[model samples]
Structures are given as C-alpha cells and as structure tokens.
Target chain A: MYDLRELTEAVRTFNRDRDWEQFHDAKSLLLALVGEVGEVAELLQWQPAATVREDVKAGRLHTRLAEELADVLLYLVMLADETGVDLGPAAAVKLAATAQRYPASKFRGQAPERQ
Target chain B: MYDLRELTEAVRTFNRDRDWEQFHDAKSLLLALVGEVGEVAELLQWQPAATVREDVKAGRLHTRLAEELADVLLYLVMLADETGVDLGPAAAVKLAATAQRYPASKFRGQAPERQ
Candidate 1:
C-alpha cells in the first residue's frame, strides 16, 4: 500500500533537492505527462488485447511497461502538485460522483451509451 | 493521505459490481486512458503557462481541471491494475533511478539537453 501523499512529498523533495522546480510549470508537466502516455499507447498499440494481457501476466513486458507507466504517473502527480490539486481526494470524489451517475443496478454489464 | 491499494480495491469492486470488467480489456482501457488524457490536454491547450497557473491558483478552473485530471488518473490506475503493475513501487523505483540519472550535484536548476 502506498500513500499518494507520501509519493507527492517524495516528488516534492526530489524537485526541491535538485532545484528543478523552476523547470516544472504546469504546462511543461502536462506536456511531459502527455508524452509519457503516448509512449504507453505506443507500447500496447497494434497488439491484440489478449496478447498484451498475457504478456503482462507472464512479465515479458513488465519492466518496460512499469517504467513507462511510472513516468506517466510521476509527471501527473507533479502536474497536480503544481496546479494545487489534491489528487487523492479529487479522485475519490470523482469516483463517488461517477457511482451516482451510473448506479450498478441499472448499468450493470452495460456500457453507457455514447453521448 | 490515500492508499493506492484502497483506490485499486474500490476500482476493482466498482467494476466487479457493474460486471464492467468484461468490457475493460487491456486495449480498451489504454484507449480510454488516452482519450481522457486528450481531454486534459484540451483543457490546458493554448493557455499561457502563467495564466494557467493563475487560473488554477484562483480556483477558476479548479472544478473542471480536477474532474478531468481525476478521470485521467482513474483510467490510468485501472489500466495499471489490469496489467498487474504495482504502480507505487514502480514509481518509487523510477524516481530513484531518475535521481541517479540526473544527479543534483551536476544538474541542479538545469534541464537536461534534448536528445
């Protein structure tokens, strides 16, 4: 179990120790996050879903996937920090709101219709 | 502070209860993550970085930004879970490796040169 706050503080300390915060404005962080996400997409692209899942399960792509996903996550956490958003609470609230919007009794086994 | 484990459990339960896991193959989840990231990029696109910082600080864009960012996060967490990557440790290791890659003694306040 990892606390998001702990990770955030680690990220904060990492930046502060290096004086790298100056380079991490919201826009740059967002772009970095997007680039990392694109890498992740590229990795999984053109592969069948089952192949991707099986490879991941077998740990064949584990290290590379872990690295790319970590980049996406760290950049995201940094961006949220720069923008003054408490990501954990925001995510919890969003999940609650989504639950309200799509009650299981009705939406079970059904994808919501495209808007 | 929020535990990534708790969030992961909540997400798993949410999908299980809805029987939505069947629809969340690795490729579909990756696409969903990409789409949410696009939404985040759209929200910040074309804004001056300083202006974005000011708007976020003043809470003018807080709700929308939070919602969009939260979506990105949830989808990401779900995808990571699907792939069996334990995100917290991966991120920690990645950050540690990055610290080694760009030692503050040499790189302080300097962005790495573009490759």
Candidate 2:
C-alpha cells in the first residue's frame, strides 16, 4: 500500500533536515548503493545454492539480508530522488520493455529452474 | 508517483503469466536479487570514486548501470512481494533508524565528500 513517492520524499526530507543532501549526489548515491549491494552478495559468495536455502529456512536471512536490502533500498530511493528518476514508473516502463525483449513464451522454464 | 504495490503486482503478473513462478520462490528470488546486485557492484569494482563520477558524467553509465539497476529493482519488487515485505515502509523505517544511527552532523563532511 505504500507509495514510492512517499518513501522518496521521506528520505529527501530526512536528508534536507540534516543538510546531508550535500553528500548524496547521483554518483555518491550510486556508489553507496553498489557498496550495500556488494555486502549482500558477499554474504552468499561461494555458498552452494542448497546452503543458501538452508540459511533462509533456518531464519538466518532475516537479519543480514534484510539490513543489506534495506540499505540498498534506502540508497536507491535517495539516488532516484536526486537524479530525478521515478523508480516505480521507470521500472514499470522497463518491465514492459523487458517483457517485449524476453517474451515469456520463449523464456519460460529457463534459468533459475532450481538448477 | 507510482505505487510500490503496482510495481510489485506488475512483476507478479509478469511471472504468473509466463508461469515463471515455479522458479521464483522466496529463496530463489533472494538469490536472484543478490545476483543482480553483484552485477551492479562489479561495474564499479576497484575503480576510484573519481572514475565513477567520470563514468557517470561521460555518459557511460546510461545503459549498463541503468539496466543492472532496473534488474535489481525488478528483483527487489518481486522478492518483497513473495515475502510479504512492504519495501517502501520497510525502507522508510530503516532510513529513520539509519538517520539516528549515523547523525548527519557527526557523519557529514565525513564520507563521500568528493575526496
């Protein structure tokens, strides 16, 4: 039920209130987003897919992955806000394009089919 | 102006229409998200911050970064949908926690000061 605009604005206001906008230009935000994304990847690096599933089933993903994802999401919102990219709409448009590019009829039962 | 629910639903329907849901349970989605995140990080890996900005300004980041980011965002929406996590609110809450954790006054003029 939450809106992307609201989330973007909340981050905008938080940054403005703290005068942190100075630190969040498009490039910085992108790099920061990449950094958090790296952290998320690092947690799973070299682990077998089965082990990853076990980590999830054991409730081990709730903390680390959630926090890393939260960080990635936070920086993504901030970056989109600073760069004037409306992520939801941009994503919607991209999804449509992707649907065209990778027609499901041709791509179904493809990769990630649980190996 | 787009809603998170809409984006999530769009991705959900995309998967369902293609019957790709079989490949996208929570664990699968998380792993997919992580894979896209790594792709993003690899683009900027080991490059100095200055080079990153140059890549941004030289119009080098448009295609690769955007596509990677779009993939990341798409997977993120799908994962949140499967897990019942509201990314917008979860991010808002986490951002607030982050604001408190790293007070801008104390952390500003600290990192990503363009140097």
Candidate 3:
C-alpha cells in the first residue's frame, strides 16, 4: 500500500518544482478540492443507485471516477499539509469519535434520521 | 504515521458492526461525501484567504474543519471500497500521470489557463 506521506511528498515536490506553491494558498487549494469533488459528484449524479457499483466496476465509470477521486485526494493532502494537519492521525481520531457517538449497538441497522 | 489500510479496516469494521453496509451503496456514499465537502466549503466560505492558516491553527476553525474533512475521507473510503477501487494505489498512479502531463521544466511558474 502506498503511504500518505509518499503522496504528500510527491505533491510537495510537484508544486516546488513547478514553482506553484505561491498559487496554492489555503483558499485556492480548498477551491480546487471542491472543484474536483464537483467533478466526482457530477459523474455519479444521474446514474441509477443500484447500477453504480456495476457501472464503476465494468470500466464504464472506473477510469474517470478514479481520476477525479485521485484529484480529490491530492488536493486534500495539499490542503492538510498547508494547514499543518496530519490526515492519517486526524482521520483515526475522527473515526474513533464517530464510533463512540454512533455505537454499533445503538445504530445497528438504523439509519440516522437525517440520512 | 498512520496507515491508509488501517483507516480502511476501521471503516470496514465500523460499518460491518453497525450493519450500515446496506445503507452505503456507491451513490449514497458519493452524495454523503459531497455533503461533507460542502460543509468544509461552507466553513471556509466567508473567511479571508489570508488568514485561513491562522484560523485553522488557532482552534477557531480547526476542530470543525478537521471533523468535516474526516467525514469526507471516510465517505470517500466507503465509496471506493464499494466500487473495488484501492485509493492509495490509484492516487499514486494518478499523481505519476499528472507529473508527466505537466513536467516542471516546461510548466514552471506557468499557471494553467483554467486555474
């Protein structure tokens, strides 16, 4: 498995080599992240929910979805790096908190009212 | 220093234990990801770009942004798992392709027209 640090280093090198760091302020990175996310949402927008897994697996949506998802991840790494957040640890902490907040014993087979 | 596989496994166990896999079809996960992204965007929306780093560092936006970003990541992981795509490898490949597409020597200091 590729490490998140490797990805962050790759992004850091890419931006540094291209002199692009000046353009990647927090807001700009956030906007770019949002744009990539929009692309992902757009690709998945009109598809029938039941067919989504098959469509993605059959290569119909796989390539594009993978690319868009990659963009999202890269921008996310960049944003986190800029803001001094370590994603892996942050995510771990969040997941633990979420587990406590919605324990399986309580939430099992139950959808949130909002969901 | 946390591993992506660790995060994926945690998500898997959480959903499995909650029997929430039934609710995590690809489209629903994508929509949830988008919604979380929107929350992140909304949190950053009116803030001046210049102070984003400080705001995030000083705890004003840190806690909320971290939670929203983590939700985005968890939903993204769920979506990819449902679709049989491994995010770490996919991102590594995409980053490589992007590096080739925009070589630093050629694109240095030149912003893409669209950006």
Which candidate has the top score in lDDT?
Answer: 1
Residue-level lDDT of model 1, residues B1-115, one tens digit each, is 2788888899999899999999888889888888888887887887788788888777658778888888888988899999998989999999999999999899888887756
Question: Model 3, stretches more than 4 Å misplaced?
Answer: none
lDDT of 3 by residue, B1-115 (tens): 3567777888999899999999988788888888888888898888898887788887768878877777888888888888887888888888888889899899999876664
lDDT of 2 by residue, B18-109 (tens): 88877766656767877776776676566576455555444655456666667778988876665456677678678878789778778764
DockQ of each: 0.77, 0.37, 0.72
The 10 consecutive residues of candidate 1 chain A with the worst lDDT sum are A54-63
CA displacement after TM-score superposition, residue B61 of candidate 3 (Å): 1.3
Q: For candidate 2 chain B, which ten residues in a row score worst on lDDT?
A: B106-115
**C-alpha TM-scores of all predictions:** 0.96, 0.74, 0.94
- The window of 10 residues in a row where model 1 chain B has the poorest summed lDDT is B55-64
List the candidate numbers ranked by TM-score, top first. 1, 3, 2
For candidate 3, lDDT tens digit of each residue in A3-113? 888778988998999999988878888889989988988888888988888888887588888888888988998988888777887888888988898988899999866
Q: lDDT scores for all predictions?
A: 0.87, 0.69, 0.84
Q: Please report, as a residue range, the 10-residue window in candidate 3 chain B with the lowest summed lDDT.
A: B1-10
Docking class of 1: medium
